[model samples]
Target chain A: MATLDIKVLGPGCRNCVTLDKATRAAVAELGLDASIEKVEDYAQIASYNIMSTPGLVIDGTVVSSGRVPSPSEIKDLLLAAQA
Target chain B: MSLVDTLPSSKGKLALVGAGALALWGLAYWVNEWLWDWVMYGVLKLDSANRVVETVHFFVYDFLKIMLLLAGIIFVITFLRSYMSVERTRALLGGKRSGVGNVLAAGLGVITPFCSCSAVPAFIGFVAAGVPVGVTMSFLIASPLVNEIAIGLLLTLFGWQITLLYVVSGLAIAIVAGWVIGKFKPERWVEKFVFETKLHGEAIDPSRGLTIKQRVGIASGEVSTIIRKTWPYLVVGIGLGAIIHGWVPESFFTSVAGKDNLFAVPLVVLLGVPLYSNAAGILPLVESLYGAGLPIGTLLAFMMSVVALSLPELILLKRVLKPQLLGIFVGVTATGIILVGYLFNAIIP
Candidate 1:
């Protein structure tokens, strides 16, 4: 089983909520053993160099930002990452 | 007497209102110039730089002129409301299907200067009007980048090179960025409201002729509405422009933004995203950046961001789009802006 560390980063805004929901759904569908983390600290978020929030991080890499990824696209990437 | 009430008919009142507003503005300009000059030397410790100051001074003063021009434009739009129908839009931009032709149509998008952020209303209207996704995207991107005021100012200050670079890339980004948005037609990410406009009115029917009286009546109403809509924006916008014009220093801008700093270009793009500004307001800043030593790519990136990602326009767009699509637009625009900034410097002189 592949394990993934996913992060939904924002200031607890509405977009962050959507991204968190989307991330959970992606994680469950892919059947990957992943723990999702939400980073809301402004300083920490700024350190990531993302001016806008609701960014997605997979395995410490910011994969998608400024928008949430579609479930299918996320699942596909998860499948590939496991393989 | 109250300004609106004093005028006889609403339309006649508007003309009188226009005259009153201009009179107020002329007085304000004189006071502003005198106070600003004093502050420049006394508090700010800045003085006329061997006459470079005058040109630089024009940078800010010009925004005031633009505000006045906008007022005139509003008065015209008041009358134009009757004549400037979507049917007219179809007449002008319709019938041409060529890529180059489509681009030219898209270029005209900048002339409209609509809000840059994702809005349900414009997105709805464009889609409902059956404008292609790419074409709509081009207009969306370019609408904020180049406008008459911005272009005229660029031409006056920077000469042909800066102006040409601005126009070509502004059009190119509109086309390419639009195509990219089209490619990732993640329909699901678009909020429910955004799709509503697309649900109906997919085609434009033939235009009907208007009677002379109907035309005149509509024109008068349009002038009032458009003027009212555009005036608040102009006053607040020029107020900010005057500040940017007077305050931001050349040495500081050049030191940070200059050509040697490779990262400066993307830095500008990043900086521009949050601010609520238009091409007319931002052009002066961009010109100063170049004067200060900013790389062309960086300046262009900043310009696109200022035009495309301003907060007020973004708020307007959010009414139509879900937060996800909004984020995508901002993200995509940032990336596209940076890419084009580099492209322009490479292709042009």
Candidate 2:
């Protein structure tokens, strides 16, 4: 199986925290080797062109912006990315 | 690993810090009294009836008290704000039914520490996240108008009753105005570019693995940044309040905006719309207006108008909303605020 790369974008607020945790949990549940990275710098966040924080990017594609998805939902997204 | 870690982490240290802070706070009042006495009685030798002396005293005392109160309260609130992100709030309000969404958005707006400057970013974020336009409006209206800093300052200046009244009325306006705007289907007024803008790129979430120490550091940084950004406004607001409280003739405003004056509420609202300032900056002026015998309703209306309906905020919204939608938003919010002003004046006093 190929390792997955996940990126979460925010300014370290609680929502970003929650989403980061959920992504980790999903990756673990799927037994996937994923490198999860957090981007907190304002410039970097804006570079994504995302107006909202707490954005999720899986394998370079922006999956969600401005919200935290459930762990199950994250798991589905991760599995789909793997396939 | 470090010499700092060698110090004892004990209850005694905590107690000592607590006692020290309390003592300093208590000393602030004494300092205020001493300064006034020295300046007005000992040095200047001005009698109580001297309006200039009284105004100077008022300015000095209020400046000290309000600055202290603002620093402490802003620190705590900014610290609390660290836990709330706009993205999370958008998520919570997104995809809800209209009325409920408005209420929830308004409620959330009360807790979120957003200022007028953030309106554009929050608006785009909410819309992009699938939150209804009306619900987004509710959050935007309530966020600036019903902020914690404004509420804290109001509570410090006025008693709890007025603060509570402000909060309730502000929320009511936000919810109702948002619902009304929602009914109009104002989404048509949103710029086409907003819907078409696709945010793409690699992103990161720095908060993913923060330790407790990092969180505390972040909170401290936020406190410093907020105070730095807002201190000038605080000083100016309090300075204006002092002038109004001690120097301005009591009859000046009452003659024009007296409680019995039917046009005061709408007039004040009109006066407030073009001015742009944060709640903290405008609140001291509001407090002074109340002191100057402005009706509670008129003052409240004025405060809401200044905080919520400023032209700068409207211009910012223009990035996403068409002119017609912005007009509807302004009209609805203005009407709601005017009605609230009338309602409070009729009932409260």
Candidate 3:
């Protein structure tokens, strides 16, 4: 399996931090080959067309925006992406 | 981790539980005053007229009331708001000119799901997508200014007439302020990078394909998160309100910021501009101050300024707006709020 590229987009708000942690935990829990990156630049975040902070993007597709999904939900999203 | 997350996954059972909880909440709200009265005056034998006892009673009653109001309203608003997003709002406002656009933008701003933390990016996205600066300004102003929390509290505390007046005046401020800023030719004032930056991907609409259960889950999560985050401010605000209710003499506010002071509204707006706080923290204080003989207009202006024009939000906007544009943004919005204050003061009396 190829390594999946996941990006958490926010300017380091509390929700963003929680999302980052949840994503990492989910990745580890599922034993998936993934690299998570934090996108903090406003221009780049806007380029993704998400007007809300704490957006979750997997493989360049926005999966969640504006709110933090739970760790289990993140795992579900990750699994959906793999399939 | 929300309590909703631990519940059964069957949609029908979840809906049943939700309805049950809501019914219980209604019962609790209906009985809150009497219950507090019983505990304070009936059971404890405390004198109702005593200042200490009155203050404590006000605190207990208000704390529960505001909590219930926050939980119920936020859940409903969040659930409904799942149907709207900033991306869709921008699409609605795109390619529109200033005048009618400003009106629509202000209206949309009130309904759009936006956070101050994302203001910079949203601003960039709107402008880059051909939404005029003034229209975008109206959206930004109305987003925080005319929110559900303020509406819920104002209606609960000040009655429907005052609440309607507040909502109307808030919309007026946004519309007129954006129109005035548009006349100034604001494009030159924005940072050049905001124009130069090219959007790369298709805008994703988050509201699409959401299940009812998912929306409910989102609402419950929002209720818990916002309450947990703001409880400290709410407690402090209500505590201060309790003190002012029972202890502060009416003469103190009458002399300080009462109707007789011509500069009261502007001064309060100025003071509020620098101080950052949400409506939850400020409205309880506003209630206490209103009780202490302060005029409603000045208090409303103060609340509007604090929530709409904050230091942190300005700093964030500075990334996309030149200092000149930021100055006009603050100036125009502040002037509108001050005018509304004076207007309300004169008419309300």
TM-score for each predicted model, relative to the true structure: 0.53, 0.75, 0.96
- On lDDT, the leading prediction is 3
Query: Compared with the real two-chain complex, what DockQ does model 1 have?
Result: 0.01
lDDT of 2 by residue, B88-196 (tens): 6766786798999999999999886554544555676567557889998998889887879888988988889989989998999999999999999988998765555
Scored by lDDT, model 3 comes in at 0.89
Worst 10 residues of 3 chain B by lDDT: B1-10
Model 3 stretches astray by more than 4 angstroms:
none
True contacts kept of each: 0.00, 0.22, 0.67
Report how far residue B20 has shifted in candidate 2, in Å: 4.9
Stretch of 10 with least lDDT, candidate 2 chain B? B1-10
Cα lDDT of all candidates, in order?
A: 0.57, 0.75, 0.89
Q: Encode model 1's per-residue lDDT on B1-349: one tens digit a residue.
A: 0122233455565557657866886777566666656666667777676345654465456555555544444444433443333324434554444355347556656554232322333455454445554455566666666555566666766788878877777777676666666566645555554344322222221123444333334334334434444455555544544454556676676677565567876877878878656565555556544655556677777777877777877775565456766776677777878888877666655
DockQ, candidate no. 2: 0.12
Candidate 1's residue-wise lDDT over A1-83, tens digit each?
A: 65787778776655567678877887887667998899865434434434234567677665654434445546765666666
| Model 3: TM-score, first chain | 0.98
- Model 1, C-alpha of B207: deviation from truth (Å): 11
lDDT per residue as tens, model 3, B1-349: 5455677778898889889989999999999969989887889999998989999999989989889998898898999999999989988997889999999999999898788988998999899888999999999999999998789889889999889989999999999989888999999999888888788778777777777777887888888878987788788888988999888898998898888899999999999978888787688888888888889999999999999999999999999988988999899899999999999999997
Q: How badly does each model clash, as a count of residue pairs?
A: 11, 6, 0
